[model samples]
Target: MPTGPALRIDLFLLAGLFPGLTHAAALGAAVDYAVAAERAGFDGVWLAEHHFSAYGTCPSAVVLAGHLLGRTDRLRVGTAAAILPNRHPIALAEETALLDAVSGGRFDLGVARGGPWVDLEVFGTGLDRYGHDGFAAALDLLLAGLSGAGTVAGDRHRFPFREVAMVPVAERGLPVWVAATGSSTVGLAAARGLPLLLGMHDDDAAKAAMLHGYARAGTGTPRAGHASTHLALVADTVEEAEAALRRTMPAWLAAAGGSERIDGSAPPRRDAGAYLEHLLAIHPVGPPARCVRRLAATVSTTGVRRLLLMVEGAGERRRTLANIERLGREVLAPLRRLH
Candidate 1:
């Protein structure tokens, strides 16, 4: 496993809000995951935000963050990225401040420009409609609001307000993160001296380029300097892990609209065996040792100390908890010594 300065390990929940799941049930499961994380010594739980999709059910990751923060004593709760354009900056700022106060500053607010056509439509903003200027405008309001400043007429989400400060000012200044994908976004975040909430799909070399870009821009570490990783366990055998990856990832990708299942019985998409071969070749999936090596290569490339593992969930409570337990012991426990 990769070793270095202490890594801040976090868990990112991408549990699908499939049919027959009540909102209450979903919230309950999130709580359970947080409780498990804290007990197992994970650093934080990062909730993902999605609109009108079974891929991610958490409509309000901040709301769930507060709930999780209230439930766990030490575990930090954050949004993977709150769709900034979909909400008024004032609302996002106020809620973030309140959560920070109650959690004693354990909340990390990650703001992003919303995308994917359906998500835009859910908020009546088309994919083509929400351009960088609009996102920057919203981001400006958010940053200003976080600094407890008020807005004027130019704000797109809300306009023409007084020296408005974020009510219930944050206990202290909260650590705010911007989600970065492309070079422009990374540069935008670096220019502001803000750390990044990075995504997980890029290869090590690609990620290294992004990291170096951030470094060339300036050093701003996200929550003790961690990047996110897509994770799973294969203690018994690599083959078994491959099967799970093949089985779970396609449905997840299809649900999130990243890929499709053109035919259930076809090769590649539905064939877990075929898909598993391709997946393990790229991502952090293997027996504990290989997983650690792949993940370490990732950390070394990115030079970020924190890792939020996006563990795959097949909608089973026991399976989710079990995956957490396995990774904590098999993957992270050994690495914890470096800290």
Candidate 2:
């Protein structure tokens, strides 16, 4: 058996409002999945944030994280990310501290420099805030407010406060995971001694390259363990799993559409079929043994101790619940022994 750090498997909730499902039901399903994940012995649940789109219904990842933290005693609840570009860092930091206090430190705060989508305009952050400088300013304040004696000040993006004290401080000082898809974001996170939340679309080799980039950008010592997300499903056979994904995922992806630009220009429509094919080829969307091997390879190649699995692509509550249970019993159990 391979000996190393223990594997921590988590469920990644996108809160997708699938076809024929009402918004209420979609959100409800996310809650149900989190509860089931805990019972199935999964280590944690990470919520995705999106706004003004059916691709994902949850606008506030922190709010859902707090609720799930209340729902499960031992399961760690986190944001796969809260979109920093659309939020005030101080406000997000306060919520992070509050959730930390209430959940007894079971909350993880992962943030991302989201794209130049309409969310920026709607949140009043503007299109300029989509730039790296804007994201860095916001992240600086967030980090300071979480780690300092409640005094955070920044003049960038029209946000400047002088020595304001943030109450209900998280005494434990929670680690913030930066979601990175490119070198700019990876370097930003690495410079501050932060961990990364890598995306699912990238293969193990690509993800390994990103990890190497982080090492090159940062000091020698790594501060926190990084996390990697992968689309996952489990069935008796590969054909069954692939067929189920084919039947449901394309609709969900198509519904997701393209990121709306603020300047009234339509973004290019993503080929849902091609993307789905890519994910099936690269991800662990198969039987238990196959999933175990793929996930183990991910850990070995990227050296990421945390794995967030997207097992809800089938868009059916019953099927997702069964997938979670099977993952725990078959895939996660076997992987845990090896690591």
Candidate 3:
């Protein structure tokens, strides 16, 4: 068993349109995953947002969360992130407030400074808002709106508005997490006393550094717990786990090729095989014992309590369900004993 604190395991749903599945089918599988996760005794489920791509089908994470919230009673549903650059701050705040009220505060709002994707043009937020300054401005407006301030204004992008009180204001500052991939964004989130949502690609050391940076920049104490994502799977053997991932992830990664920057400068395409190897090497993808070891290392090294595991690497819905069952029974059960 792990020598560290027990984990609060949650499932990370990409709502991915894997090979041989329609958009509707992919969404159906996501719903099943959420319901199954709650039944499996997961703490929560986070939904990822992607637009105009087969890599992920869910365009609006907030909307998906609303549907999932109605489907389950005890499960906490959140946007892995709702893209901050793609929508107005007030509109997003209002939606978050409504969901928080209806769900009895089971709803979490995690926002990302989305890339320079075509989503910016489609949403008419422009490419400028994809930068650091713009994201800071947008985040500021969002905080004000959620904090029950009578009026809100923007600094750099200058989205100024008159004195307008937010209706159905959050009883307290609603739970908010900012997705941070770099030190700059981590510092931005920290200065405001907001917890971060770290991605899966980074290793334990890198994640630890980000957390340390946030601690240094922010107030002595954090407002809420920070969250991190990881690639996870549970099977009978290491080879079996690797085989399942090798069979499915290549196609999904291939579909996710090419950055969607509107500036007409496309980054080089990714090599699926190489990337998959890197992910397997970094994450936990073996049997229950091995999975526990890797996860415990993360908790010990980074001091993070919440982990969102991506278990859909097996592609098929039945296999994904089986993975969840095994993880809950074989992995989570043992880890729970550690606490």
lDDT against the true structure, per candidate, is: 0.70, 0.89, 0.87
* Strongest candidate by lDDT: 2
Whichever of 2 and 3 has more TM-score, that candidate is: 2
lDDT tens digits by residue: candidate 1, 92-111: 88899888877777898887
TM-score attained by model 3: 0.95
Instruction: Please report the candidate that would top TM-score against the real structure.
Output: 2
| Residue lDDT tens for model 2, 188-278 | 9999989999998899999999999999999764566899999999999989999999999997898777568888788778899999999
Error of 1 at 201 (Å): 1.2
Error of 3 at 103 (Å): 0.6
Worst 10 residues of 3 by lDDT: 149-158
Error of 2 at 189 (Å): 0.8
Candidate 2 minimal-lDDT segment of 10 residues: 148-157
Off by over 4 Å in 3: 1-6, 150-157
Better of 1 and 3 by lDDT: 3
Ranking of all candidate structures by their lDDT, best first: 2, 3, 1
| TM-score on alpha carbons, each prediction | 0.84, 0.97, 0.95
| RMSD values, in order shown | 4.8, 1.3, 1.9
